[model samples]
Target chain A: MIWQFDLFILVLLVITALVALKVRDLLSAAMIFSIYSLLMCLLWAEMGAVDVAFTEAAVGAGLSTVFLIATILRTTRRTTD
Target chain B: MSDVLTFIISRFNYWIYIVLMMIGLYAMIAKRNYVKKFIGMSIFQTAIILFYVSTGVKSGATIPILEHGHDIGHAAAAINPDHYANPLPHVLMLTAIVVGVATLGVALAVVQKVHDQYETIEEPEILFKLGQE
Candidate 1:
C-alpha cells in the first residue's frame, strides 16, 4: 500500500467527518457524510479490499445519503444544536 | 527521532481509525439531534470496519483471488496464502455494512416517527415534552 495516498485519503476522511458533524444544515451534513464514506471507500480500495470498497460505495455513500436526505426532508432541514 | 517517526508512520492507519472512532463516539454522546446521533453511529461502524479491513491488508499481496484457478491444468498448483489479502475481515465487514444500513434505516424511521409525534427530533426537546406530560 502506498502510505502517501493512504495518508491523503485519511486526512480528507477526518475533515469530512468533522464537517458533517459541525454543519448546521442537516442536508449539508448528509452530503459531507457521504463524502466521508466515499473517502473511506477509497481507503479500503487502496488497501486492496475491493469487495468492501464496492459495498461501501454502494451502501454507505449511496443508500445512507439517500436515507439521511429523505429523513431530513420529511422532518427538518436545520438542526437546533 | 527517525525511528520514532518511522514507527508512527508505519502504523498510521490504525491511528487514523482510532481518531475517527473517537469523533464518532463524541458525536454519539454529545450531539442533540437524533439524526446526527445516527450519523455518528454510522461513522463509528465504518471506523470499526476500517480497522478490520486494514488488519487484513498484506503489503505486496493482491486482492484475495486465485490468479490461476481457472486454468484446469493448474488446479494442483501450490499457492502461497500470504500472496493474497485476507478475505475473512472483508467478508465480515460486508455483513457489517449491510447491518449498519439496516440499522440506520430503522433508526431514521423511528426518528421520523418521533418528529411526527413530538414536532421535534432533538433529544432534549422530546424529553422536555415527555416530562411535561
Candidate 2:
C-alpha cells in the first residue's frame, strides 16, 4: 500500500486549503484553490480513479481558475473580512 | 500501542476527508465574502465526490475496462467481477463535475452582478447599501 504517499498529499491539500481560506488577497486565494484542485487530482489518480482525476485537473485546475480570475478582473481585488 | 497506530493509519483517509468537509462547512456558515463562500462550496462538493469514489475502491482490482483482445460481451464470461474496479461512482462523478463547473459559472455571474449593482461583494456592506437605498 502506498498509503504514505496518499497521506502526504492529503496533508498538502489541507494546508493549501487552509491557506486559501485564510489569505487576504483574492488573487492568492484563487491561485491557491487551483493548487488545491491539482493536489486533489493527484490524490484521485493515486487511488486509480483516472477519470475523476482528469476532470478535476481540467476543471478545477484550469477552467474554474480562469473563471475566477475573469470575475476578479471584473471587480475589485481586495476582499473585506 | 502499535494497534492504535495501525487503526489510525488504516482509517486515516476517511478521517482526513471528514476534516476537509468540516473546513468547507465552517467556511460556508461563517465566511463573509460571497466568493469565499463559493470557494467553500466547491471544497464541500469535492469532499462528497471523494467520499463516493473512496467507497468504490476494491483492492487488487484493475481498471473497469475490457482487457486487450477481449471484445465486449464475448469476454464477459471469462472475466471475474472482482477483477474490475467499480465504475458506477466514476460515471456519477463525471456528471457531478460538470454540474459543479456550471454552478460555479452561474454563481460567479451572480457575484459580478451583485458587485455591479451594489459596488460591494461583502454581505454586511451590501446589506447596508441596500438598506440605505
Candidate 3:
C-alpha cells in the first residue's frame, strides 16, 4: 500500500520533469521545477527522513524557487525555441 | 505474503529518489540558460540530501533523546531505549543547506552580472553576441 504512494510520487516527478523540459517559457519551467522539488521533499518524508524532508522543503521549495523567479525577473522570460 | 510485499514496498522510496536525482542532473547538464542550470543544481543537491537522510533510518527506532530519569550509561545497552538515528546526517544536512544557499547566492550574483554585461541570459544568444564582438 505504501508503495502506491511512492509510485505516485515517481509519476509526478516524471511529469514535472517532462514539463520542465518541454515548456517554452523559462518562468514556467522554473515553476515546474519547484513543484518537482516539493514532490521530492514529500518522498523524503515518506522514507522516514524527516530532517531531510524538512531541509528540502525549506531550501528547495522555498529559497531555490524564489531565487529562480528573481533570476527570471532579471532576464528575458521568452525562449528562442 | 503481505509481510513480504511490505518488505519490498519499504525500499521503494530509495528507487524514486535515485530516479529523480538522475533527471535533475541530466537537466542541469543539458540546459543552456543560467537560471535553469541553477535550478538543476538545487534539484541535484536536494536529491543527495534525500539519499543521505533515507540511509539513516533504522526500523522501530525512536528519536535519539534519553528519557527523563534514565541513566545514560545503563540505557546504552538497552535493546530498544528509543533507538535514535545517527545524528551525523542531520548535522551534515544543516551544513549542506547552508552551502546550497551560498552556492545559489553566488550563482545568482553571477547571473546578475551576466545579464548586465550581455543584456541576455540565453546561453546561445550570449555566445553569438560575444562572437559578433
Candidate 4:
C-alpha cells in the first residue's frame, strides 16, 4: 500500500516536470514547478523526514512559486518560439 | 509477489529523485527565459534536499530528544538505535532552505532590474535591444 503511494507520487513528479517543460506560458510552468515541489515534499514525508519535508513544502512550493510568478508578471506575457 | 514488489519499490525512490534532478537541470540549461531558469534551479535544489532527507530515514526510530527521567545508558538501549534518524541531513536542509530563499530573492531582484532597463522580460528581446543601442 505504502509502496504504491510512493510510486504514485513519483509518477506525479515526472508528469509535472514534463508539463512544466511543455507549457508555453511562463506562469503555467512556474505553477507546475510548484506542484512538482509539493509532490516532492510528500515523497520526503513518506521517507520519514518530516522536518525536511516541511521546509521543502514551504520554501519550494510557497516562496519560490511566488517569486517566479512575480518575475513573470514583470516580464512579457508571451514566450517567443 | 507482494514481498518482491515492496523490495523493489523501497529501493527505487533515490533513483526517481536523480531523474527529476536531471530533468530540472536540463530545463535550466535549455530554457531561454530567466524566470524559468530560476524555477528549474529551485526544482534542482529541492531534488537534492529530497535525496539527503531520504538517507536519514530509519524504521521505528523515535525523535532524538532524551526521554523524561531516563539516564543515557538506559535510553540508549531502550531506544532502537538502528532506526534512529541522522540529524545531519535535517540540519543541512535548514541551511539549504535559507540559501535557496536568498538566491531566489537576488535572482528576482535582478530580473526586475532587467525588466526596468530593457522594457521587456524576454531574454532575446533584451539582447536585441542592447545590440541595437
Index of the highest-TM-score prediction: 1
Off by over 4 Å in 1: B1-6
Off by over 4 Å in 4: B1-11, B60-77
TM-score of each: 0.95, 0.92, 0.78, 0.83
Worst 10 residues of 4 chain A by lDDT: A72-81
Candidate that scores best on lDDT: 1
Model 2 lDDT per residue over B1-133, tens place? 9999999878998999998999899888888998888888889889889888877778888667768545667775787868777889988997898899899999999999999998988988998988887
Each candidate's interface RMSD: 0.7, 1.3, 2.8, 2.4
Residue-by-residue lDDT tens digits, candidate 2, A1-81: 277898899899889888988888998999999999999998887776889989999988899999999988998788875
lDDT-superior candidate, 1 or 2: 1
lDDT, residue B52, candidate 2: 88
The candidate scoring highest on DockQ is: 1
lDDT of 3 by residue, B62-90 (tens): 54444543666775566453366666776
Tens digit per residue, CA lDDT, model 4, B43-106: 7887787778767767666444445535666666676456556667877887897798789889
Clashing pairs in 3: none
TM-score of 3: 0.78
Candidate 1: tens digits of C-alpha lDDT, residues A31-75: 999999999998998888999999999999999999999999999
lDDT of each: 0.92, 0.87, 0.75, 0.78
Q: Cα deviation in Å at residue B108, candidate 2?
A: 0.5
Candidates 1 and 3, the one with greater TM-score:
1
Residue B16 lDDT in model 1?
A: 90
